[model samples]
Target: MTSRANRSRNNRCATALLVATTLVLAACKAQAPTPQPEPATPQVTADTSAQPARSTDAPLPSEDASLAPAVTTPALPSAFVDKVWKVSKSGAVEPGTTYVFLADGTLVIDSPNGTPMHGRWSFDKGALVMVEEGISYPTEIIAIDDSQFHIRSHNPGEPVDIELVPAPDQPLPKP
Candidate 1:
């Protein structure tokens, strides 16, 4: 009788120890960090100045630029203002229209049909606003580089999104 009781007690102790070890192992595994995949490196192309343009499928006025406080002299990107940009796709401006952003904050738009349109452009806090004639266009610069200048104009009735590419070297417009 005594031997049988001793054997039963020993078996229960061993089973309890096994259960505790398994629980601890499970808890540790739950807390372990998972391995993450490494990021792929960017490929270099012949035209290093060019980058893929963003999709303009979405409607304009993604963000309100009017709420942004006015700036005295908005700092425009040197690369964007340096070259003339030709419009490829737009809702407001005609296709093939050329744009020149001067260092003195002059925005010149040369439409194929009419005379050059003069406007004042400013960029501050990622908000670009252009004033021409008597209308204000709050513009969002989607992307700008040496090769491309894409923007979305927040015109009240019909918001215009435009894609522009670097045009051939041309003479700077008169101030």
Candidate 2:
């Protein structure tokens, strides 16, 4: 009967399916696991934008360069807090990032549209330290002074120094 023939055909099909699954599992077990790629090392670039051009006639701060007491924290005044400051960094002119300083003391930084994108920044050793994040040309620019930020990208080549002048009435970093 046709029903008997169909039952036999289905059994054969079921056996074929089981065999196929077993072979797939065996093949998967035979293959070795792929290794993950190592993370790329960070390339340090010298950003001289923070670098000051000490005038030959300019006098130094003090005869004794002493370190501040660890207990004493010299605070950046709240007068500039919760305000936006326009930054020209790493040899680049205006149209830079606007850092909004909040009262609680966090920073909200806006990225530059046209210029090279600098990375994340935090105050380190009294100056701003920037690490290249999600940027096309990964650059780590450090703040040298109020007007200068500098860094050179070893990966991309060519050291870049940026000069940043604070735009008047710019909001301070967010709290």
Candidate 3:
């Protein structure tokens, strides 16, 4: 009887230790720094009508690195990238949602449901384009300041505007 009681206590101690170790590992992973992604190559289309047709034997334009045009991606506003934004008003996204725009074009969104969504973002012709789950959302920056941001999404058939303010930073959960 005493041996059985000892085994039961030992099993509980082992289970608690395993759970604690798992929580500690999860916290460390959550705090790990994200790796920066490689820059994307810009797509350039040449006008074939202006130049004479070439035979199959001819070298492709990509064969000569000098011929490639220099294209630079416009940088996102410093105010937008510098802070975590929380949704104060929006018809599309729920209020209290948070957003973090990393300089490496990574967009992190946390909704009220506690699920975090990841997406890619880029700038085109002074407009913001966010790609999530393979769908692109072209957005316009209506206004932005140190403490506030406003944007209008031009999703075909479903246009909406959003207002955001700086959100207080939330610390990672501890074990």
Candidate 4:
């Protein structure tokens, strides 16, 4: 009789413990998770009108214009102005190459071979044109943001997607 009493008590304790654990788990599962807010996206619009032809001798806008509180110039996006961009991938140009678009229409390219090439750059119809030695090479800006840009070369061949990233090491040209 004593042994039977002890066995009954142990069974009851085990059942109680199992019930408590199940109730605790159920309470945890009943609680709702907090909702997360969606990320805000920047608004961007495209201009389809024809732009006036810019002369190679004509200088670009000042750097202050890009940083101004209001939008004044429509020639180039503010993100592209006064930025040192590095070619992440390209067929014609080698990777790890750096390019700087100055506020004075000067395009400086530092190749991996340590050769620095100087050219004139301009933005027309969502495309960036770089002219060197009277030869014009235009690249279409597929997408651009504050940090990076995607460009497609107009050269006839295997169309390679070129990604340009902000080069913090390369400083922007003085205004």
Off by over 4 Å in 2: 1-83, 88-90, 93-119, 134-156, 168-175
Worst 10 residues of 1 by lDDT: 67-76
List TM-scores for all candidates, in order.
0.55, 0.31, 0.52, 0.51
- Give one digit per residue, the lDDT tens place, for model 2 in 1-175: 9999999999999999999999999888866778988999999996444333345564544643562221112223332344455655544434566655354434455656653333444443433343455433333433333443333333445655544445566534323
Candidate 3 achieves a global lDDT of 0.71
User: Where is the poorest 10-residue window by lDDT in model 2?
Assistant: 67-76
Give per-residue CA lDDT, model 4, range 1-175, as digits (tens): 9999999999999999999999999888866778888897887875633232345574555643653322222336566767889998776778888878787888888887887888887876555787665567776665566667666656556655778888888776543
lDDT digits (tens) for residues 7-81 of candidate 1? 999999999999999999888776657788889889766531122233467343346555332211232467577
Candidate 3's residue-wise lDDT over 1-175, tens digit each?
Answer: 9999999999999999999999998887766578889898998995342122247785666997774422112324575773688899998889998877777788788898877888877775456887776788887666676667777777779777889988867532111
Q: Which stretches of candidate 1 lie over 4 Å from their true place?
A: 1-76
What ordering of candidates by TM-score runs from best to worst?
1, 3, 4, 2
Model 2 per-residue lDDT at 157: 53
In candidate 3, position 164 carries an lDDT of 93
Candidate 2: Cα lDDT at 84: 53
lDDT of 2 at 9: 99
